[model samples]
Target: MAEFPRNDMATAQDWLRHAVAADAAGDVAVAEQGFLQALLLDAALVDARFGLGVTYFRSARYREAALELRAVMAAGSADAATGILLGKSLYLTGEFPESAKAFELALTSMPLQGDSLRCYARAKTYATMIAGNIADALADYPALAGAEAEPIETVIRDGFGLLSAYGHRDAAAALGQLLITENPDDVVQRHLNDAVAGRAIDHVPASYVEAHFDAFANGFDDKLVNVLGYRVPEQMAELVSRHRTAFDHVLDLGCGTGLAGAHLRPLAGELTGVDLSARMLEQARRRDVYDALTHAEALTHLAAHAATFDLVFAADTLIYFGRLDAVMAAVAEAMTPGGIFAASVETSMHDFEIMPSGRFAHADAYVMRLAEPYFELLERQATDIRLEANTPAKGALFVWRRR
Candidate 1:
């Protein structure tokens, strides 16, 4: 523990103890005051400054939190934990490129701490995802040294996991770090012990999803439906009403900017939406259609509220996952018994290759194979969703009832 001396008059020890006690009790106002008091008494009290920054962070005042945290760096005393929170705060307040700097600096600390390693790893993966380099993502892997790098490695693994979850790459590449450039000394770290080289998962991995959604968030809706002819949502809605009479809950997975939620309006008692992109979720939030909005990766959101929804809809969102197992399972987990799940996927029976234009297509067989386990296929139809740009795309709308 580092000794932070306040003034010769005030015992730094007493103020620090008070600050820590207040912070642990969730009395951040008291915590902030105590920390500031310490700082006032002793300007060199790095601990108190850090405690003050943390108070702002826990209160969600991220900008103010970052300012005080950054002061720690100026005082020449910093650690991985401070860096991680500060970096996260900076990123959340829309200082994206600056967030990257904070994360990198955290990594430079000798023997990376768990949180710091993970932050940097996430930053790198998101960087790639934002660039839309699906192929390059397949090859990038984090270098993990010890417990300190666990968080970073986790982010890297999750990024690759998302690529695999969405069927962006082959199973072999996903089972291990087969796709990443590596030396002989590198060890492959999978969350599972023997899930095969690319065992089917039940939910989309967090890293790839976070990056892909954020990267595509700005132009996502326009490009997918407008440029590519995405009509999955409307068609799915039509398929549902033709068969079932009522649905209590309607959820849009990867609900980008509420495009699907808008189509689901009439059919929904209440709509709940989730997406990996905060920006896209923000756009959806403005529509006033969905009852609740969450900025979480597709799988985690669905998994957290398992068996609570009556209807789950994913419109043309499955294309991002090369494998349907994890995401489908999440949908299954989230739906009530006898609940109906509707979704769309672009079809391709050929080799899983990124065309010169860079779009992925999966065969209908691949789609059915994944859904058969948890859902009874009630109706599936081929349809086109009219894009805002007036172009139509070919897609499959499948309605499945949970068994």
Candidate 2:
């Protein structure tokens, strides 16, 4: 086995610290060199890449900027700032559809103000105008979706994604429209189709959630933990431990890849994991922390296990639900008196809004109102849940006791 110095991580972090300082001090050359050195030491370090990408972006190096920024996003940082920068880079490179998606995600995180708003509008207008000519440009796309060789839905989605990647803005939009026309009742297709059309819908279908998680189940943990800096599982577990030493029965709702299950295992006498995605459940099963792993939607599983749990942990789960009324009532019914319900959620000002990203965010006040009748708020703390486009995404973590 090859051995190296034990301080590689410490040394890499030191390099990262220096790089950030240099970047902030406007020493682009030193900053870039420092970032490169940091990456050489610890290739998995995302901060170095982010800093390098920023430096490259500032230097009119759009291609390098785009490459590094894309890598940062692929690793799990999708904040408005990163998205905006990436969008600009791609746009400058003449990748309009890809740029549109980046700008769209950025706009969802935070609405563009002043000049940024004008720029966004310009981009949107250009993309829209280009889309009007897509049908004539990709005359065979509509026919390709109906081809008998592959699933119609698969063909359409893949074709749309490919066209977008290749900067075929209008063509991709046309394909998306075809998808909607062909699969009018298909929730996943409709939601994605709507996204491409820049429409925000109130409800996200269960099928969309299942398919999204299942598709990314394999890399879920790495993206969430390593890339995005997700700490909800650990944070929630720590909060729960502060109140209770152990739980007789614990239920993990929306336990994708068993992250929360793995954290809560030591505290749970019997851990049960539930999720909408079978692939996610399979990933959870491999962790072996859960005594039972069930493939079912949160509400459906909660309905079958009424008054069954002493503790229910739902980390990064409830964001899928825009309205918590039925699910909250169901959760209350499913919990024993005085049982704990710990969860984290994306924060928003409105009661609940399905953002352009297709996920829901609830205001703290709204969540409190929903839990008032059934769960007593034991603890609620606001924290950075993860990195979105290299920016800290705000979220609120709560531990409530069933009344």
Best-fitting candidate, scored by TM-score: 2
Count clashing residue pairs per candidate.
18, 5
Q: Write the per-residue lDDT of candidate 1 for residues 158-196, one digit (tens) a residue.
A: 545443333334332442453244433322233221123
TM-score of every prediction relative to native: 0.46, 0.63
Candidate 1: 10-residue stretch with minimal lDDT? 186-195
Q: lDDT score of model 1?
A: 0.66
> Highest lDDT: which candidate?
2
Summing lDDT over every window of 10 consecutive residues in candidate 2, give the lowest-scoring window: 140-149
TM-score of 2: 0.63
Residue pairs in collision within model 2: 77-389, 78-388, 78-389, 79-388, 79-389
Q: What is the lDDT of residue 316 in candidate 2?
A: 85
